[model samples]
Structure formats: C-alpha cells, structure tokens
Target: MRPLASLFKGWFLIRRDLSSSRRLFLTAVSFVLPLALWCLVSYVDWIWHPDIKLQLSSEREGNSTVFTAGDHISPGYYQEMVVATRAENTRLLASTPPPKSSKRANQKLLRQLAPVAISHDWLPYTEAQNDASIYHLWRDIATGTKIPTDPALTPENLDIVKQNWAQLAPLAADFSLASLPETPLLKLIPQGLPANPVYLPAPHEVWRSGWRDFKAVPPEGELSMTQRYQHSLRVILLGFFWACVVGVPIGILCGVFDFFSKLFEPFVDFFRYMPAPTFSTLLVAVLLAGDAPKIALVFIGTVFQMILVVSKTTRLLDPSLLEAAQTLGASPKQMLTRVVIPGILPNLYNDLRILLGWAWTWLVIAELIGVKSGLTEFIETQGRFRNFDRVFPVIILIGVTGFVTDQILSWLHGIIFPWTGRGNPIAQTFFRILFWPFRQISKLSDRAGTPT
Candidate 1:
C-alpha cells in the first residue's frame, strides 16, 4: 500500500514537473481516438452510402429474351427454370444413351437447361447467383477442396474450369484456413441486403485472422513470418552497413575538399533523381539474381541519398570550431578524428536513424527484384489472394517493428550523447517519469533515517 501510494505520488510530482503534460495527454489521445473510431466504424453497421438496389427485368424479343438491370425477376421465374431443368434432366436419363455423333446435341441441350439471359449484367438474380457460385468455388479451393465436376461436362467447359483450378491451386496450398472466422457474422446478412451487398468485417475478426496468419507456417519450403522478418532485417542491415562504409567516406571527402565536392556533387545529385527500382533489371543483369541483386537494390536506394545528407551535415560544421582546433596546433588528421567527428557524431546518429527508416521503405522493392523471402513476399502473395486479414497484420507488424527500432536507436543516441538530452524538455520529462518512483522511495528512506 505504501509503495503504491508512493508510486502515485511520484507520478503526480512528475506530471506536475512536465509543463507539457497537456501536450502529452493530447498526443496520447490523438493515437487512441483514431483507434477507437476505427473499432466503432468496424463494429457498428452505420449506413453511410446505401447500395443501389438493382431492379433487373427481362422481355422476350424475337427468339431471345432481353434482360435489363432495371427489370425485376419474379420468384416464379426461378421456379420455372428449376422445373424446366429437372424435366430436361429426367428426359435425358429416361431416353437411351445418346450416340457419340449426338455429343454436340447433348451439349446444346445442356446449354438450354442452363439458359441464361443474354443481358445477365442487367439481371440481379443471375449476377448474384454467378457471384455466389464463384465465391463458393474460391472458398472451396482456398480450403484445399477439389471442386466436383459433372462427368458429362463438355471438353471446352472442363478446360476452362481446369485453367481456373490450376490458377487457384497455389493459393490453396499457401493459404491458412485457420485464419477464417468459424462463425462469420457476414453469413447472417442476406445476400441482397440494403445499403451494401459485401460484408464489412469486424475489427476483432480481422485481428483474429491476422493473428492466425502470423502463427501459420506455409506448406512446402516457404518461410514463415518470423523467418521472413529475420531475412528482411539481415538484408536491411547488410545494405545499410555497405552504404555507410562507402557513402560516409565519400561524403567526408566531398565535405572537406572543395575540388572533390565540385567534381562529385553533380554526378551524385543527378543519380539521386533517378529512382532505385528502375535499376532492378540492370542490377539483376549485373549481380545475376539471388541476394546480391536484392542487396544491390537496397544499396542503390540508400547510398546516394546517404552521401548527400552526410556531406551536407559535414559542411554545416561551425567554422570557429575548425579555426580553434587549427590554432591549438592540431594536425589535420587529429582535428578530423577528435574535433570534427565528435562534434558531428550526434547529428550523424540522428541522420543514420532517419536513413535506416528510409532503408525499410526500400525493403519491399528490394525483395521484389530478385529474392522473395521477406515480409514483402508475404504481403504481396497474401494480397494477391485477397487475404486482407493476413496483409493488414504484416503491414502492422512492419510498422511496429520500425517504431521499436527507432526507439531503440533513440535510446542509443541518448547514451552516446548524454548532453543532447540534458537540454531537451521532452527527454527531461521522460527521465523524471521513469525515475520518479525511485526518487520518492529515496526521499521516504531519508526522512525515516533523520533524527526526528
């Protein structure tokens, strides 16, 4: 109880000391309010823009029937179609097996049994049925089920079905069925419900689906999310390392030597304008695929930009500082090593941190060029499969990882340049908040030990 009281007291003291407490509060609210709004919008079925309730109609014209989107189909039309199909099937079964020469006639009769209006686009009923069939077929394939086909299905139709089946097979093999909702709320809504025909999934459902995908291991030799993240991190770090090695030295030379700056500045500036992804084919041709091309892609993306930034940072050094070092009998090498490097170290750290984030932005493009074994690959593949649940989570994961990485770098920067944080009000407030409870405990101990 005493510790808890002290903790609250410390929080109050820290809060009082931080003059920007209101700002901090607002910042927190800024994050929370959007999330709250997202949850609200997702959970509640608010009718913003209602779906256009299409009224489809069909009229007989000569030998064919014309259907229009504005026309309405009577319930009896569905019943008549069902009866006709059943009667035709019965007659086909009752008669002697058709000769091989009558195969075309059988196909024609099958088409008649499945008579669809020429203007199906205008027929809501036909469109809905078609959509539902396609949806179910996709669902079945996604769940690793082989679709059942009629034995008497024509060769042309069978070929078309086979082509679709082949295309969806990879998705089925890769898809994690556990991601789907066991009791989907969307199923409760009627197919032709007012306002919207499509289901707007709840936030919880999306989160659950994402979670499932995060934990799922793809079949075959494909990498999981964890493995992919590691690979991505490795590629980013390697590319960053190489970029720093080359760019920093060149930047320093450009900053220190007027001649070098004049010579290289134009070339670097020109290349910077050309996007890195455009070099993908060239990189592939030179590096010949594999991790080399991917790494080269990341390197190309970051290097030119890093060089320019570093050079500008170096050039911004105070002239007085350089003069003072020179006056103190400091050698050129010693001045660079001791004075210049230390002075720019803090800003350089900040620049590197910012550039590291930029490097992550290039990761997807890099991974796409040659190797597809990162978070980008998961996102791209799942996105193509229309697994928004999986895609959203991977995106969120990337954001969270970047945020954590930035924070870690910020902590490192403070450790390396302790003086920088001393003047920063935000940092001061943060440290006070961090150590307030310990300070409170110390105060209590001091009071108890005093001769009272």
Candidate 2:
C-alpha cells in the first residue's frame, strides 16, 4: 500500500509539473490538425486519378471464336482480368449443385485462374506481378505441391489465405485436375466499373488495407511491424547510449574549460552542419554492412549536435554559484562537481529529451543504409510494392512512437527536476486535481485498517 501510494504521488507530481505549460494545448492541437488533414485527404480522394479501362470482345468466324483483349496501358488488362476472375468465381459459387465434381467446372476455373498478363506500364506492374504470384500459389496448391514462398504478398492477402484455407484447399485440389495450359486468357468484363475495385481503392480502402497489414503476419522474408519496431528501438537506444558517453563528457569539458571549448567548438559546429547521411558512403566503406554502419550513422547524427547543445547548456550556468563555491575554498574539481554539474543537470536533461526526438529522425535514414530491417525498411519495401496501406501505418507508427517517447521523457524530466515550472498557477491547480483521488484513496484505506 505504501509503495503504491508512493508511485501515485510520483505520477501526480509529474502530471502537475507538465500541466504548467499552456503550450501543451497548442502542442495537442498541432498533432490533431495533421490527423484531421489526413482524414480529410483520405475521405475526399482529392487527388484520385481515373483508372485505365480495357475492352475485350469475342467474334465468331467460320465456327471459331476469336477472343481479343488488350489496352495501351497494360495494367488496364491485368485489372480487368482480376475483376473478371473474381466475378467468374462468384458466378460459379452461386450456381446450383456447387460444381464440385463437374469436368467443365474444373476447366472453367483453371481457365479463369490463368497467368496474369504482363504490362510495361508501372501502374499495373506490381499488381500484375502480385496476381501472377497468387496464381502460381493457387496452381501449386491445386497440384498438391507445397506453396512457394512469396514475400511480395501483402499481409491483408495473406490473412485472407489463412482465414479461407479450408475452402481454398479443396478448390486447389479441384483446380489440379483441370488439364489447362498456362496461357494468358483474354476474358474481359465491361468498362467504367464501379470506382471501388481493388486498383482504385478509396482512402478508407487504403486505411483498411493498411490495417490488415498491421494486424497480419508479413509475407516470407519480410519483417513484421513489431519486429521492425523492436529493431529500430534497439538501434536508436544503442546509438543514443554511445552518443551520450562520447558527447556528454566532451560537452562538459567544453563548458567548464575555455581551452577545451576553443579546441573542439569549431570542429563540432562545422561537422554538425554537414548532414550525417552524406557520410553514409564513408561509414559503409569503413564499418562494412550489418548493424555497425547503421549504429555509426545514428551516433554521427546525434553526437555532434548533442556536444554543441550540452556545451551551450553548461556555458549558461550561473558564474555566481561557481564563484561562491571557489570562495568557500573549494578546489577546481570540487567547484565543478558542486556548482557546475548541479546547476546544469536539469537543463541538460531537457536538452537531451529534445535531442532524443531528433535521434528518431536519424533512425529512419540510418536503417535505410545497411540491414534494411526496421520500420523505415518496411515502409520502403511496401511502398515499392505499392502497398501504401502498410506504408502509411508504419509512417504513422514512427510519428506516434516518437510523440509518445517524447511525452514519457517529459514526465520523467518533471519527476527528476521537481523545481521545473514550480511557480505556475496552472501547475498548482493540476497538482490539486491529481492529489484529490489519491487523498480519497488514502482516507478509505486508513478507515478500513482502523475500525473494521
């Protein structure tokens, strides 16, 4: 009970201190405004482009049917085929007797499940490739062979497979018996299809797509969001730890000693101006691949900036406190320990918290350099595959993670430096509000322990 009370008291104090800042409301609004904009852009489809349309026609000549379907934009053909296949599947499913044992049913299904037509256009390229991959997987399953690993399949499609595995298994078995060639089919449906097809998905569709990927297992050879997030956290923390070790001491030295400050200030300032990413080639060459280069990239990014900030903070320390300590017969080391360190510790903590947010910015670029196994990599891969759903969520994840981390560090700063924002009336009010519930709890506990 005492420990719980202590914890509550700590939480209460932190909350009270943070509430002192009227900027918090503005900060919250800043976050909400972007989300509102995102919602607006997504719901309105203000930038949506019209999908390419493909026309397919069949003509009978000399008792032979000639089927033709092609479009100037190749994805148009692939998109039409996908829609047609889905429609054909629905029609077959809706038919009587289920077409379970019919030879014609098997042939038609196989024909509909033919290899996707390749398109030179970039728009349909990935979709066509994905459909082709799915077809191959379906063919393999139908033939009673193991499904080949496909890293390109989005999590949503993967989830669909997992959910309908039982139904698909039998379908695959039925499909295997059909002696169909692996040729591309020219079956096309009507144009001006509803705007809600898989290709031209609305903003909600994009969100749903991303949500599925967020909840689903990543395809073969790709890291899940959880895995990527953990990797990113590890990389950022490792780099931050090393940066502190190197930067903080140097920063302290620069702050306290004029000679040290003169020697290091120019170099730190100059290097910080140069972007950390430009050094990627050198870092990669020297450190080689794997975690070393990535970690080095993060370290390079934060360390120089941290050094300058820490030095500035240390330089800002009150000279009167240092003079008082010296006049009290304290040695140089003693003056630093008693006055300089203590004087700047709170401000330093706040500086480090702000710098930590900057560290996450470097993290995405760092992860891109070597291993390709973090949230940034996931976003890049999904973006290449045009899985904007997966990409958008990971991007949002980065922002949310950084925001939450910053808030948590803010709370910690308040706890560590109780004097921070002490005189504000808003803080006083917040303190009272936070204490009320705990006070009531303590009173109830005391009453229960006494008479009952």
Candidate 3:
C-alpha cells in the first residue's frame, strides 16, 4: 500500500517533474485522445454520420454525371436517388415493347456491379475497368458462386444483379462490347453504408488512400511523391540554412557588444513586424517565377525572427562566464569567442530548432507564391475536387516529416553535447561503440605517462 501510494504521489506532485512512465503515458495520450474522439465520431453508428458513402451507384438516362462507388451524398439526397432511380426503372420495364437502349449504355450499367464485387473480395480494384472480368463477375455473383460479406449484398441489390445478368447473359457468354444487349438493364440502387461528411473521412479511408497514393506510379512528365517531398524539404532546409547563415553572426555580435546591438537589433525589431509574406508580389516581380521566389520567401519570413530570437538567447548566457573569462586576462576577442559563443551554443541550437518549425508554417504559401510546386500544389488540387481522404495523407506526411526530423535533431543534441546531460540513450550507446578504440588507446597512453 505504501509503495502504491508513493507511485501515485509522484504522479500528482504539484510543480514537480513527472515520473518517466507518466511522461510516456501522457505523450501517448496526447495523440490517443484526438484519435479516440475521431473514431467515436466516425465508427459509432447513429452518432454523427450525416451522409451515406455510396458503395454502389449508377447512371440515369440523359444524365452525363455518373456517381460510382466511394461517393458521398446526404441522407436526404441518397433517398431521393433511390426514389427517382426506382421510378425511372419502373418506367423502363413498363414501356410497351421494352424500350431499346444502346449496347454501350447497357455495358456501362453492367459495370456498376464492380464495386459490389470488389467489396466482397470477389474482384481486385485494379481490375475494375476490365469489362471482360466485370462481365464474368456479374454471372458469378448472380448465381451465388461468389458470396458477398462484410458488406454482403442487400437482398434488393442482389435481385437487381440477377435481373441485370439475365439481360446481359443473353447477348454474349463473356464480355464483348459489340455483343452487349441492346435492351435496358436494371440500374443498381444507390446503396451505401452510413458515413460522416466527406471532409471527415474514416481513419481506414485515410490509411488506405495514403497507402494507395504512395504506392501508385505517377503519370509521365509529372513529379512522384518522392520528388514532391524532396522539393518541400529543399525549400524548408534552404530557407532555414540561409537564415542561420545571415542571422547567427549578427545576433551573436549584438549579444556581445552594445555597438552592434544599437546598430542592428533596433532595425531588425522594426522590420520583423512588417510581415514576410507581404513581400511575395514584390519578390515575384523581381525574382520572377520558379523555386527562386519560393526559397527567398522562406528566407525572408524566417531570417528576421531568427536574428531576434538568437540575439535574445545569446543575451541570456550566464554573466559569470564573462566575469571568469575577464579575470583570466582574456582580450575582447577571446571573451566573445571563448566565453559567449560556447556558452550560448546549446540554447541557440534549441532556438534554431523552434525557428525551423516556424519556417514550415509558410510552406504552403511559399509554394503557391511561385510556380505552384511541391506537396502544397497537390493538396490544393485534391482539395478542389473535394477528395478529403486523399488530402489527409499529404497533410499528415508534412506533419510527420517535421516531427521525425525534430526528434532526430533532439536525440543528436544529447549525443553531441553529453556534458549538458541531454543525450539520447541510443545515441550515447552508438557514440561509445564508435569511439571505443580511440578511448582505449588514450587510457593506455595516460597510464604509460604517469610516474610510479
């Protein structure tokens, strides 16, 4: 009981550091909470699913728009489709002499079964547009040779398949576009499972779409996912690198002496507030279109703020280090180099890490400012089409790229500055292994140099 109480007390201690287990638990909970809420809103039936995602759909006469599988519509709209389609179907069957339709039209009608067949694992998605395979699938499903489950065919949809197959089979045993029936075939009803609004797709949908998109081969003359990712990384890293190159020395000078500070910090402070993005049109006008303007925007956006933040971090260094250096007869150059720079390096690294993240916020805007390249362009195009499932992956990829890079930098920080007591265990272990021979040789030399 006492041990348990101590463990619990460690958890609730006010203004104190949490135990490592609690730290990991809270970190995990940070992600889990949002996902759990999303799952509740998505998977829990009768909660907030305001739309039905059509697993099967059809084309009506004289309408060029075709709603196929995976389309979303409001419940009211779905019901309207059902009523109108049923009415149109009745008119077709009751018409005297059973109104003839084009073989192409009936051929397309038979293909609506593709979604149902795919859902039941009776067909592969890549084979979807294969009319010959779709023809055979219709026969298999109608005769019950293929059983549908998970989303087993509703009795109504099953009946439509049987009836449509009856008309289709009479024309040809297998798929022959020319051999397709001239008679009208029954349209599959607009059937769907319950779904949330398209903007908030299910987690499975996001994962599946992400996988498919990443694995797919892009069209020729277009960029692949890797290429887009490389372009985005190039923009961010180049921007941050240029900012550091131009800003770090100025910031360090300002921190070390009042002369530089009075000359530079005042102007930097004033200019940072003017907004980096406001320069986009001017940049495009001067720099012209391409990666030049995009990279320049990131540099302009991040550099001013980087200078200010790094200057502040420099000033926060312990004055006692300066006092100690002065007492040792260190000159002004030695004081700046030996005392100030080394002392501020750790904090400056952290400051730059944060500023790197700040630079990423401008990525979408930066890409748009020029020729519209990188992941942002892809996101905008998909967003316009309202394919939210496809959109989530690109957004998630950007987030993940930043997160993993930060974590790697963080782990390396600890390894690179072990005296600061902030290195990763894995990094420390690797460092020890890699330097073992040198460390052993140094020990042997030290022992030989000592007098007995």
* The best candidate in terms of lDDT: 3
Q: TM-score of every model?
A: 0.60, 0.61, 0.84
Across 322-352, the per-residue lDDT of candidate 3 in tens digits comes to 9988999999899988889889998999889
| Residue lDDT tens for model 1, 315-393 | 8888789899999999999888878788888888888889999999888899988667688888898677555555777
lDDT of each: 0.61, 0.63, 0.84
Task: Give the alpha carbon lDDT tens digit for every residue of 305-370 in model 2.
Answer: 999999999999988888888889999989888888888999898888888899998998998986
For candidate 2, the clash count comes to 1
Q: Kindly indicate the candidate among 1 and 3 with the higher lDDT.
A: 3
Residue-level lDDT for 17 in candidate 1: 56
Kindly indicate the candidate among 1 and 2 with the higher lDDT.
2
Error of 3 at 292 (Å): 2.2
Off by over 4 Å in 1: 1-18, 47-201, 423-452
